[model samples]
Structures are given as C-alpha cells and as structure tokens.
Target: MADFNPGRDEVEDVAAMKREGDLSRFLRQQIRDGQARRDKPTAAPKPAPPPGYRPGAWPSGTSPPGPLPDRGADWDRALDRYRNGEGSDRDPCHCGACDTPDNNQTEEN
Candidate 1:
C-alpha cells in the first residue's frame, strides 16, 4: 500500500524552518536582491499643505494679529440702498412678504 502524507507535514516543515531562522534569512536575501536591482535612490514626495492652510491668511487654530473690523456701517449702507430701491429689476424686494414689480422701482425715477 502507498503511504498517505497529510497536510500537517508541510505545515510542520515550515514551522521547523522558521524556528531555525531560515525563513528570516530568506526574506533578508530577497530584500537585498531587490535593493541591488534598483539603479537610483528615489526622492520622497513633498508633504501636502494642511486642510486649514489659507493662501493670504493664517492657518486654522491660530488668531489674527488684531481685532476684526466692525461691519455694522456696511450693513446699514446696504440696507439703505435696498430701501432706496437700488437693486436690479430681477432682484426681489428686501421684504419677504411681497413680490410685486412696483417694489423694484427706484424713488429717484
């Protein structure tokens, strides 16, 4: 009768090779061969800027050099223009309650 060889024998051989440090030596030799095959040292790529980096301003998490300017007067001027009917005909009135065409007419006319 022919002898039956189980799959465990192959696994046992691998374990024995690993225990004897043969596997590590084989891996080291493969790495050395790969390194020798390369002709040039590859330059590492430059790291990209962080997500919070602004072109002309400071990065996120840091405060600006001075206090921010008050924009209340700007808002008041815009509201005054809107009330004076300075917006284009296509633009809706500032008041949300009405959509009449007369709302777009300027008082100067």
Candidate 2:
C-alpha cells in the first residue's frame, strides 16, 4: 500500500497554508503594495484658473438674452393695486389672455 499524502499532487489546502504562516506573509505583501501605490505621486495637478476668473459668470462678449417684453399698463395697475392693499384672492387676474373666452362658447343667435 502506498503512503497517503494529505495534499493532492503537491497542492496544499488553504488551511494548511495558514497553519504554515504563508497567509500572513501574503497579506503583508499586499499591504506593502497598497501603501506604495498610495505614496506614488499622481499626475500633474490641474492648472489654476486664470486671474479674476468668476465662477458661474457668462463668458466675455456674451450678454444674457434681451430683456423680457414690457408688462404694459394692465400689469402695472394690478401690481399697484396689490402694493396699495387693494388686491384680494377673489380679484380676477387681468392677464388679458384669460379674459378671452374659449372656443366652446358661441354667440347666441
């Protein structure tokens, strides 16, 4: 009868390697590799922004879109009423567009 070897064809099990202290050695090697990677300098730092660079500023020579169309007299009156404490929740909006009737209503014959 042949002598029985615990390892099959010279391949040792993980538990056997741990008992033999190889696990700690491998772990230390991995830790050293990680530390070396972190200590290595990264690529060149990003260039600093130009002097007086204002974040969120529109680029030079570009202006915001033209001012909104004037709100006109009706809007002014509404705003004035509100400021003078004459406006109330029940007051109808005078936006003009809403004052027009929808297509569903027809003039009575």
Candidate 3:
C-alpha cells in the first residue's frame, strides 16, 4: 500500500519559499500556465476565436447570408381543400406499381 499523510505540509523547500515574492511568482506562473497557456500558438481554432480575435468579424473564406426562399405551396384550391377537411378522408395509396414516371419518382414503390 502507498504511504498516505493526511495532515502533512508537503511543500518542497518550505523554509526557503516563505515570503511574498516566491508565493506571488508561483501564483502568477500558475495563472499564466492555466490561461493563455504556454503551448505553441498556432492558427486559431474553428468556431472558437483566438486570444485577441474580435466578434462579428468574418473569416477569410465565407460568403454572406444569401436571400432566403419564399417557401410552402401557395395554391388556393388545394390549400382550401386541405383546410376545410374536404381531402382528409382519402386513404393513403401504398401500391408498388404506378402509371406515371413522375408519380413513380415521387411516390414510394
């Protein structure tokens, strides 16, 4: 079993590092190592900006938001039939064979 000392002050060279300068230096180093991190600073991560990158700024190769489509079928009679429940009771067709190529392409086999 490993030796475990619960209340032991496990400071390395505790007598030498008693004053403010040593503690301050140690804390500053720890904070720096935790934050901007001393790794090789390469290209900024995608979806995450680097240390000094600004928001609302687009990258090198991105197009602006293009015009959105005016979606949904706007036919009056077909929409009116669906709305008024006139076309509600018809059973769904599930036959494998079809007469029209367009219908075959659209409808399932």
Best-performing candidate as measured by TM-score: 2
Q: Estimate, for each residue in 1-109, the C-alpha lDDT of model 1 and write its tens digit.
A: 6785759887787688799989888779979998999999789998897887778887777877798799999999898876765564635654534557655444553
Model 2 weakest lDDT span, ten residues long: 95-104
Q: Order of candidates by TM-score, top first?
A: 2, 1, 3
lDDT of each: 0.74, 0.65, 0.55
What lDDT is obtained when candidate 2 is compared to the true structure?
A: 0.65
Count of backbone clashes for each model? Answer: 0, 0, 0
The runs of at least 3 residues in candidate 1 whose Cα sits more than 4 Å from the true structure, single-residue gaps closed, are 1-65, 90-109
Instruction: Pick out the ten consecutive residues of candidate 1 with the lowest summed lDDT.
Output: 88-97
TM-score of 1: 0.26
Q: TM per model?
A: 0.26, 0.28, 0.23
- Alpha-carbon runs more than 4 Å astray in model 3: 1-56, 72-89, 94-109
